[model samples]
Target chain A: MKIEEKDVFKSYFKNLTLRERAVFEGGITLGALFHQFVGTPVSLKNREILERSIEESMKNQPCVEDISVEIVGNLKEDEYVSLEGKMLDVKLKVKVENTVAYLRLRYIKELNYPLMYVERIDEE
Target chain B: MKIEEKDVFKSYFKNLTLRERAVFEGGITLGALFHQFVGTPVSLKNREILERSIEESMKNQPCVEDISVEIVGNLKEDEYVSLEGKMLDVKLKVKVENTVAYLRLRYIKELNYPLMYVERIDEE
Candidate 1:
């Protein structure tokens, strides 16, 4: 069997230890990219880099990235956008209270790929 | 077994017929939401709603959403942000050329969920 990027990613998450998972969470929310060091204190430098990036990107607004993830976030609003630059409408929900939201990179269209037209639906 | 939201989402994509996928793709890019009509014409009203949503969301960058998926997008730049709003930095890569990027709703930190610390890596 061939090892693909998706497989490597799946394996990485599947293999995370409890403590490691916690650290990973911290890195994500904090936007700190850390290189795991067996068992020891975290490096401040990596944490700083992540922090800076998060701030910069947020300021830019509607920015793009090679890779991106949101560990924990609140939806400013209930909304969805079509793939094309056109057509954007907001979905109003009665529950305006703070709700835990997840950011998913769905593949709706593909210029070239085995998979196209992907979407991220609520993970049950 | 409990039929979870994830299962439903997964099944929906898994079951998309080739023709349906093509129509779905059109809906996404064109920002048209279409209700599948078995083997008949699409519902134009739904398409109109979708188109409206896409336009509105893009105008408000850094905005939150209940759900989001970018099927095909060009990362304006190479970058990664730490989960915390504090960090914001850009990773400049030599390869500025266009590359297919995937947006993943990595579960680095989940407020509540059976599966936490979910990260979307390339599907190999």
Candidate 2:
């Protein structure tokens, strides 16, 4: 975002603390990642590109410092299935001024949900 | 979710009030909807099905009572663009116990952001 555009964007979030903003944005990104791609067709042929595409597209969100996405599980060559939440393991980094938040999205077997949670936070 | 599965899911959210839980789920759904479908391939041929598919997939998320998705803007016969956030208009309803949260995800021209916000909350 340009300086002016960034200012306009920041204006909507004035009520939130930097940490709150960071987590809020992170939550949105993780949720978006899971929901957006959950049903996409994936096979060995498109798996790498799909992972890369997910990372690149999410980078467009505000304050994203970096992201890594992995689509886990085994696939046989001749078939493709709709991607499932359990198949995704993702790490996301979001920065808000001096605070950086590390967030993750992965399925928890105990809960049977694709969970999004804050892994850690750092102030620097 | 089966009775046992639902119990495990509810255990994780014991810390949040019903209202907060409703909104939190709403936020994730809105964020997920935007990010998941933003880059999907679309054209006149597949627009309606794509919108329906998006709605059905999101319904699998916890607490999603109902959802409506519209892919706005024009598409020509032979070309398609990566789905942009600005092209989406969505209304999501999430229920937590007796509270229902109505949320919206749409582009705000003035802010130039696809803003996701709580439109209203009803307790019944």
Q: Pick the candidate with the highest lDDT.
A: 2
Model 2 over residues A1-124: C-alpha lDDT tens digits? 4422466566666654566567667777889888778889999999999999999998987778899999999988989999999999999998989988788888889876677766776888
Please tell me how candidate 1 rates in CAPRI terms: incorrect
- Model 1 residue B15 distance off true place after TM-score fit, in angstroms: 13
Per-model C-alpha lDDT, please? 0.24, 0.81
Candidate 1 chain B lowest-lDDT run of ten: B87-96
TM-score of 1: 0.16
C-alpha RMSD for every candidate: 22.2, 4.9
- The per-candidate count of clashes, in order, stands at 41, 2
Residue A52 of model 1 has an lDDT of: 45
* Per-model TM-score on C-alpha atoms: 0.16, 0.66
Please list the residue runs of candidate 2 whose C-alpha ends up more than 4 Å from where it truly belongs after superposition.
Answer: A2-5, B1-26, B35-84, B87-104, B117-124
Model 2, B5-99: lDDT tens per residue?
A: 37656765655566656765776788988877788899999999999999999898778899999999999999988899999999999898899
Over B1-124, each residue of candidate 1 has an lDDT whose tens digit, in order, gives: 2111234333534543332222222212211111111112113323334334534542231111123422121213343221211111111111001221122232222222111223222122
Candidate 2 clash pair list: A32-B32, A36-B36
Tell me the lDDT of model 1 at B108.
25
